[model samples]
Target: MVRRWKRVMAFLIAIIFCINCVMNIGVKGTYAENSNKDSNTEEVHTSAEEKEDTTEIEKETTSKAEKNKSDGDLSVDKNEKTTNKTEDDESKTKAVNNTILDWDTYKSKTTLVTVDDTNKRIYVKTGEALTLLSNCSAENYKDYIISLDSSVTGGAIEIPFTYDGYEFKGLGTKECPFEGNFNIANIKIQSTLFAGLL
Candidate 1:
């Protein structure tokens, strides 16, 4: 009877030890799985944050690039306008040079007229005189009319003509050749003879 009791006690002790070992192994495995899961979650969060940061940086770079392009376009437009203005000035100068009229060849009331190139005026004898057409009676004079102030010797005269975009104006003698100032638009011509006459 005593031997049987000892055997039964020993068997119960062995069974309890095996149960404790199995429980400890299960707990350790669960803890290791939880640790691995936490590490993976942290990695995923870090990756998501990096992606967001990269997206923001890309957006900023694109915005700056677009602004620079618009500035460049404006610069190009300004340069083009300047070039066009320069070309217009050149064309106006050429037109004035090509339209010089010789007072000797011009058919006036009398041919007794003398031109002073240095003084930019015309002088006629006391007995004879010259004349300029003061009316818009020709086909080429359709844009404007001429008005001469006979009271003043060197007064402003409203002449008719336009070259490109310049209005022709002159101040000269109504009974003699051009004896005062002539201008194309706002540019004054320093010559005794009329320019762009029809």
Candidate 2:
């Protein structure tokens, strides 16, 4: 009976030992799996942070590029405006230079004669005499006489005058009657003849 009881106790001890071993193994496996899961979560969090950082960096780069492009466009626009204004000013200066009249050549061919307070006469050589008046009034003796000989031929003439804030150009031919009196008012006259013994 004593030996049988000893064998039974020994078997129970062995069975308890096996069960404790199995329980320890299960606990270790559970701990290892939890550790691996934690490591994977840390890796995922780290990757997400890196992705966010890259996205921010890309956005900043794009913003900087856009700002630089806007600045470049503004500079180009300013340069174009400056160049256009410079060209416009140069063209206006050229136009003003072109419009300046040369008076030296005109003075050699013309003579001015003052008649009275109201009448002034321009006498060319046997061609046409241009008359100038100070006011818009016509009187009998206020007329201008241009004397020409019978041998003078006929040609075209231009008479320039200013009256009432306007400039006037009178076209005449020397074939018109010359032994007559002419009247002009409010005018400064310049006459040129193309022909006729003048």
Candidate 3:
């Protein structure tokens, strides 16, 4: 009876030891699996953070480039504006310098002659007749006579004819001749002369 009780106790102790060993192995395996999962999660989180940082850096670089481009465009626009103003000023100066006549003088000296009036065509028996001609369609003719304020010397009078709308003017004496085809549209004929009439 004593030997049988000892064997039964020994068997019970061995079964308990095996159960404890299996429980310890299971706990170790579960701890290892949890540790591996934690490491993988940390790696994934680190990669995500790197990507976000790269994205932010790229955005900043793009913004800076855009700002620089806009500044360059503004400079170009300013230069163009300056160039335009300079051109306008030059044009105005040219116009002023090339002004044909003083308006007050032009109004005083200019005269119109109509084609129908025989009196409009000045017939000078003493000096060469200065004839004004035009190819443009006729409108009205006002006599523009700038006769000598005083008689010229040597039995010859130099009569000045200032016509407003003539394309050509003739000035000639029996001794010497002078004629000009002028662009009447551009020139303000301030003064001209007729000499040596029949």
Candidate 4:
């Protein structure tokens, strides 16, 4: 009986030792794969929308519109430069054949330049680290994905367009244009008189 009792205690001690070793070793390697499972722990999951919200940058639009009555109706001062809308209209009518480029920014991102020849309108979208040249209309669309250079990731731009510039698409640094592919959906060759008419 004494011998049997001693054997039982020894078996229990060995089992406890194995359990401790597994717990410690699994934690350093793959805890999830551990043989000792804990069922009481709650799982955490985050949705794609939540992930996107976290990645978004804070932006403040300069527009000074009136606040809601609940927030205290305070009128914002009108922007002086925004009145350049009139000048933009003038640019529409004064379209010269010469291509005008405003791509002198120090940063890079995705850019969408949409040309509507029939309506004589242009749309621009620039996003973070992206640039694209596209020819599109209200109904149909085509992209100008030049060399697939990944560096030219475009932005979601909503700025006003400069008048009378031909579409040109580019990607990567000038020294490394082949980093990716670049494509221009369409090209328009115009003389000084014909460019403004389109």
Q: Which model is ahead, 1 or 3, in terms of lDDT? A: 1
Instruction: Indicate the worst ten consecutive residues by lDDT in candidate 1.
Output: 126-135
Candidate 3: clashing pairs of residues: 112-141, 112-142, 113-141, 113-142, 114-141, 127-196, 127-197, 128-195, 128-196, 128-197
Question: Clashes in each model (backbone N, CA, C under 3 Å)?
Answer: 0, 0, 10, 34
lDDT of 3 by residue, 90-122 (tens): 777555434433423322332421222343332
Per-residue CA lDDT of model 4 for 1-198, tens digit only, reads: 999999999999999999999877877566654422442222222444554555452221212222243233222223333456657755764553133233322112224344344553334333211222211111222222222233334432221232223232222222222322224233232221011111
The global Cα lDDT (0 to 1) of model 1 is 0.48
TM-score per model over all chains = 0.37, 0.37, 0.32, 0.16
Off by over 4 Å in 2: 78-198
Q: Please give, for residues 1-198, the per-residue lDDT of candidate 2 as tens digits.
A: 999999999999999999989989989999999999999999999999999999999999999999999999999999999999989977775554334223332224344322332443323332222322221122322334533323434654334443222222122223331222443322233643221111
RMSD of 3: 17.6
- CA deviation > 4 Å runs, candidate 4: 31-198
**Candidate 1: which stretches are off by over 4 Å?**
1-14, 82-198
Candidate 1 on 1-198: residue-level lDDT in tens? 999999999999888989888888888888889888888888889889989999899899899888888988888898898889888887876664345334444324234334444544444421112223222112222232222223335433322344333333332323333333322222223333343333
* lDDT over C-alpha atoms for residue 5 of model 1: 96
